[model samples]
Target chain A: MRAVAVGQAELKLFWRNRTALFNSLLMPLLLVPVLIAVDASGVPLVIGLVGFALLMAVYYNLVTTFVARREELVLKRLRVGELTDPEILVGAALPSVVIALGQMVLYCLVVAVVTGVDLPSRPWFLLLGVLGGVAIFVLLAAASSAFTRTVEMAQVTSLPILMACLFGSGMMFPLTNLPEVLAKVLQYLPLTPVLQLLNAAWADGPVIKPLTVVAVWIVLGTYAVQKWFRWDPRR
Target chain B: MTAIEVRGLTRRYSGGFEAVRGVSFEVERGEMFALLGTNGAGKTSTVEVVEGLSRPAEGTVRVLGHDPFAERAQVRPRMGVMLQEGGFPPDLTAFEAARMWAGTLTSPRPVDEALEMVDLTHRATVRVKQLSGGERRRLDLALALLGKPEVLFLDEPTTGLDPESRRNTWELIRALLREGVTVLLTTHYLEEAQALADRLAIMHRGRIVAQGTVSEVVDAYPSRISFVPPAGVTLPFVVDAEPSGRVTLRTNSLQSSLHELLAWAHLNNVELSGLDARSASLEEAFLAIAEEAA
Candidate 1:
């Protein structure tokens, strides 16, 4: 119940900032027209767009959010109340998660209408992929904030994961197109299984491997958050 | 009953700097205890531990009979903390921030009442970034009071307020004390401590140099009597003469010393120009401790 209040406040703040609103809600849509203009296939395009939305709306956005709140001492002040550390984090990440989920639905509808692609044949996989992706990315963003000293530094510190997800996680291009050895290694990247699960929802593909991968990443992400996530700014 | 207790509480930074060293004090219910100190004397560090913001490196602290750090869930709802800096999101209006804070408490007062307590109701719509420094401090107090906490921890709560606002805050705090709220305050302004704290501890270099009622602490230091020495007239007692021809005397018994000087002057028919006799103030005791530590 308290987490919901914190989320409501965070959502209000999210709306007041025009830049964040644009980045979370509008930036992902900008890629939609481009993919459509290029006449990309339905399944791959939807998968790539989902990956991009999760990356921007959850990961990068939360990195800045955590860093800024820490530096501003908002996290410290909130801790003085009844809110636990986990409650504070989950609450802060609520708005971004909601936005990402909303974006995924909007993207699916747009792709389905324009490209004449069928909606998800297995909607459960899509739901799992979206929910799992949000959780992992939120954890990853918080862990990244440990090294991020300032909101401005988030741009620099968040680059490596952003690049890995873009090029190595099969978000931009399918890992199957690369050598088998490279594809096998790239499948372990955080975003790969998420894209795979999204693909599994729309087309007939192996679900167990991607599901296990998603579960493993969630575990790893949770561990990383436990080990390194900092609630207070460095003195 | 004791509302807060600390024994040999020590806090160390990551770099091994001991900010608070074996500090101990007790605050009774319905009483105010001020922690007064020089800059970097660990007043804030000590208060943070009691607020359950951090754990002590050594010793133990209890708030209302529970270890604050370990039993935070039980104690937090009953205590309010106004940090040195509010650190509220700059984008939030004063009212929005109060309402948001109120949401976290189990039972909170009306947001408008909290704001009005700090005289911040008029500024409720202004963004925090646009508020003045004093206004921000008041907002911090408002949020702290939202839960109607039993124990209040104020770390320099009025640091940036104007004189009028500071007085208003004091009145508000006094009202809380009347209603049986326990207050633990830290402040650089000694007069604030003198005015508000029923008892206080003066800390220097991470240690409490003096702990007592305001007069008790002030009494430890000597009172002063100063005036220009009458030309070519010997004084009744020894005096330290300044270069400007003014002589001064420090004494524990201010009344006796002043009476003696007046008697000697009357007998000699010599005028003691610029005569002034005053007891030591908290500022004097505070500065003396700082100087002794140095």
Candidate 2:
């Protein structure tokens, strides 16, 4: 309940920041449609782009919310109350995480209906990918804010994943396209395995290949990000 | 009984800064205790540890008989804290924020009642972002009171408040005390401390210089009577007489001392000027102590 309350409060603030919402939602509309022009024929292209939009609308935007709260000393203030550390953090992350989940579902629906993007062979693989991708990225975003000096720095701090998921989160090119060695390396990048799991699930490819790989990234990414997260803004 | 008992509390930051070096104090139940200190004097560090937001680098802090760091769950639900910076989310209406906090407590005061206590019922629907600085502080205090907490920690609660707002906050706190709520407030405003605290501890650097009732602590210093001297009309030798003005003398005694000086002065050539006597207040005592510590 505490976590829900915190998340709900964060969600309200997230909606109120008009510029952030416009950029996270509408700005992507213009570019994604244009970007989707090149490979409208392939279902993988649409799935990948939808994944990118989820990361944009949900994952990336949530980072700024937590970053702004920490900068404002909201997290520190919340800590002084009855809330435990986990309660405070989980509550803070809940709103964005829920939004990310909703956006992913919406994106999946939009692609399936409009572009006739087919369903995944292994539904569990895509489900794991969606949940795991959000989990890993939320932690990574928090960890990223430790280095971010201000909310403005959130844009720059998030660029690495923004670009990586573009080329690496498996939302852009399939890891299979690169040289065997490089493909294997890119497959292990933070979003690579999750995106691949999603892609594999969507295409009904052998589920085991992406599932085993994606699971490792999720576990490893979640561990690394939580261990390194800094809730207090240094000023 | 002690509502707050801190023993050898120490807080050493990661950058080799020992902000609080073994500081400790106690606040009796239902007493208004003030933690008085200047900026960067380890006050914030010590208070954070007490609020259970940070662990002490050494020693123990117990609020209402529960260790704040080790037994946070026990202390947390029973206490309310208002930190240096107000923490209410800006988008929520004041009423919503109060109600949300009320949901977290085991035995909370009604949301409307808490708002009414702070005189913020009129602004219940106002968005937190829309509130003025003083209104926001009242809201922060309102949230702290939502739980009807037994122990309330207010750090600089009146920092940005106007005189009227500060007085209102003082009255609200006084009412809480009347209802037997234990308050631990930190403020640099000596008058605020003097007005509210039944007992207070003055901090210099990371150590307490004095701790007691205001009258007891302030009366530890010298009381003085200052009056214009009757030229060449002083009788009886005075111990610590400071006469700097053209004809002014500050003496340790007010009654008998004033009478003797006046009688002698009347027989002589000068008339006593602007006679006034005062005991050192907590403010005077605090400034004197801080200067010496500096």
Candidate 3:
């Protein structure tokens, strides 16, 4: 209940900053046009764009958010209240999670309309993948923030993961386009299974293997967050 | 009931720096206890331990009969803390931030009332980054008071406040004190300590050099009486007799010193001009302690 209140506040603040809102809310939407320009059909491109939005929502947005709040002592102040460490972290991530999910829905609708493609054959797979991606990336963002010493340093520390997911996770390009050996290896990166799950939902492909891969990443991400998440800023 | 107790509290950082060394004190319910110290005097460290923000290396700390660190849930809800620096979200409006903070506590006072308590109702919609330093301090106070906490910890609560705002904060704290709220405040302003603290402790070099009522600490230092005697009149009770017809007297008792000087003037039909007798003030005692520590 308290986490919901905190999340609401975070969401309000998230929108109030026009620059942040532009980056988090509108940046991915801007990418949709670029993807369409590159791929005239744009169906697979739209799916990749949605995955890219999820990456920003949980990884880029949340890493900087946690780092900025910690540097400002906001996280330390919240810890003094009834909220536990995990409560504060999860609550802080809630705003970005919601925004990312909303963006994904909007993207799917736009893709369906633009490409004249039908809706997903299985909606449950897509829903599970989206939520599971949010969960895993939220934890990874927090775990990444522990090593981020300052708000300025967040930009530097968050870049490697951003590049890795964009290039390796089928965000900017489809995994099928890669060499057989490269695709096999990239398939195990943190965000690969989520994107694969989304593709499976759209194309009526197998779900269990991708689902298992996402579950494993979720466990590893949760463990990383629990082990290294710093409630206070690095001193 | 004792609201806070620290016994043999010692806090050492990783680099062999002992911020607090065997410091102990208690704050009673309905009382205001100030902790005064110079920079690096361990005042904030001691307060942090009491607030359960940090643990003591070797000692016991209890707030309302519960170990603050071991039983944080029981003690934290009942206490309010104003950190040395305001930690509010910069993008949040003052009103929005206060409302959100209030929601984190149990049965918090109305957000509007808390803002009004700190005289911040007028700046309700202003973002925290736009607020002046004094306004930000008030915002910190507003959040601290939102919970209507039983014990309040204010670390230099009025550092950046102007004179009027400082007095207003003091009034707010006094009103809470009247309602039996225990306050443990650290301040560089000696006058603030003198005005608000029922009892205080002066810490130096991680140790408390003095702890008592304001008057008791002040009285530990000698008072001074200086006067220019009438021509050809012998000085009485003179601690120092200057050759320029000026006499300086030192005594622990100010009242008797004044009385004897007046009697001496009357007996000789001579006037004692420029008579100035003053007991030590808290500021004086504070400086004396600091000087001794140096």
- Tens digits of lDDT, candidate 3, A1-235: 7787678889998887675688788788777766666563545765676678777776888988898888888887887676666778878888998888888778777777877876678878778888888888898898899999876687899888888887888776677899999999998887888888877877877678888988998899889988888877666
Q: After superposition, how far is residue B95 of candidate 2 from its true place, in Å?
A: 2.8
Quality of candidate 3's docking, in CAPRI categories? medium
Residue A4, candidate 1: C-alpha displacement in angstroms = 1.8
Between candidates 1 and 2, which one is better according to TM-score?
1
Per-prediction DockQ comes to 0.78, 0.59, 0.55
Residues A1-235 of candidate 2 have per-residue lDDT tens digits of 6667676776777788896678566755565565566444346655665566556766577677777778777777777777777777777777666765665566567767876866766778777877777766766676677677787877888898788777765555556667888877776676676766776675655556656765676676567656776667775
Evaluated with DockQ, which candidate comes out highest? 1
Candidate 1 lDDT at B70 equals 95
| TM-score of model 3 (CA atoms) | 0.89
Q: Docking quality tier of candidate 2? A: medium
Q: On a 0 to 100 scale, what is the lDDT of residue A231 in model 3?
A: 70
Q: Which stretches of candidate 1 lie over 4 Å from their true place?
A: A33-39
In terms of TM-score, how similar is model 1 to the real structure?
0.97
**In candidate 2, which residue ranges exceed 4 Å CA deviation?**
A40-42, A203-228, B230-256, B266-270
For candidate 3, give the lDDT of residue A199.
77
